[model samples]
Target: MLEFVVCFTVVAILGGLLLQRLWHYRAEAERAAVQMVIANIRSALEIKVAQANLPDGSLDFTFLTEENPLNLLKVKPVNYAGEWYRPSGADIGAGNWCFDRADKTLLYLLNNVNSFEDSQTKLLKFKVKLTRLPHSPAKPSGAPETLGVAFEQVKD
Candidate 1:
């Protein structure tokens, strides 16, 4: 009887530890998925900038900031919930992407909130901003300055 009880307790403890490890892994996977989406968005933004630069020697970055960055992508992620103005938590839900038009920020509501560290609100917010590279000495004086796009994390 004593041996049976000890074996049961060991099995129970092991089961609990296994469950905790699984949750940690699930949170890590969620973080990776979010990063992948952000990377795709960044690539799309770069393509848009290049396309714009081809047409004009001077690029106006003001419009880019106000525009929805997701629109630049040829195909958005399946999890994307689309754009919203002043979206509430219930409206956005977890494991979804939403663009908050009110502040021109993209929001990702995390489903695995246990280990997500980007925000305390269990949401990750990002903003697209224009980036300018320093003038290169090798470039000709008349050459247009290099411009790029940056995906910056925003605190909510």
Candidate 2:
């Protein structure tokens, strides 16, 4: 009886440990996925800005969300895997990132949906900043514009 009880306890403890490890791995995977989505969106935006030839050689805030300005950028809409990524604050069902063009900076929010409970392991909230640095535009030679991109995880 003693042997049987001890064996059962050991197995239970091992199972619990395995479950905890798996949960940690799952959270890390979610964070990586969110970061990759944000990176792709940023790349697309940079390409769009370079092709647009803005009068001031900087990204116009309106191009981030407004359809009219977006069309003029000549960059394909953000697409990943087999789905199309829509604008932020739109139906988030098919998208993982949201775009916010506030004042002078552009913001990309990764994993914008907060579906996890307070007690549950939550995905990281990545806030990517896109700032247009001040520089003189190259005269008519079509040099690509320079923009600064930075990212930080927001703690809730």
Clashes per candidate (backbone, < 3 Å): 0, 0
List per-prediction Cα lDDT, in the order shown. 0.85, 0.47
lDDT (Cα, 0-100) at 113 in candidate 1: 76
Q: 1-156 in candidate 1: lDDT tens per residue? A: 999999999999999999999989998988888888889888887777777788664477678799888888888888888899989878888999999999999998889776567467788899998788899889999997787778888874
Query: Which one is best on TM-score?
Result: 1
Q: Which is the leading candidate under lDDT? A: 1
Those runs of model 1 whose alpha carbons end farther than 4 Å from true positions after fitting are: 55-58, 139-145
Residue pairs with colliding backbones in model 2 are none
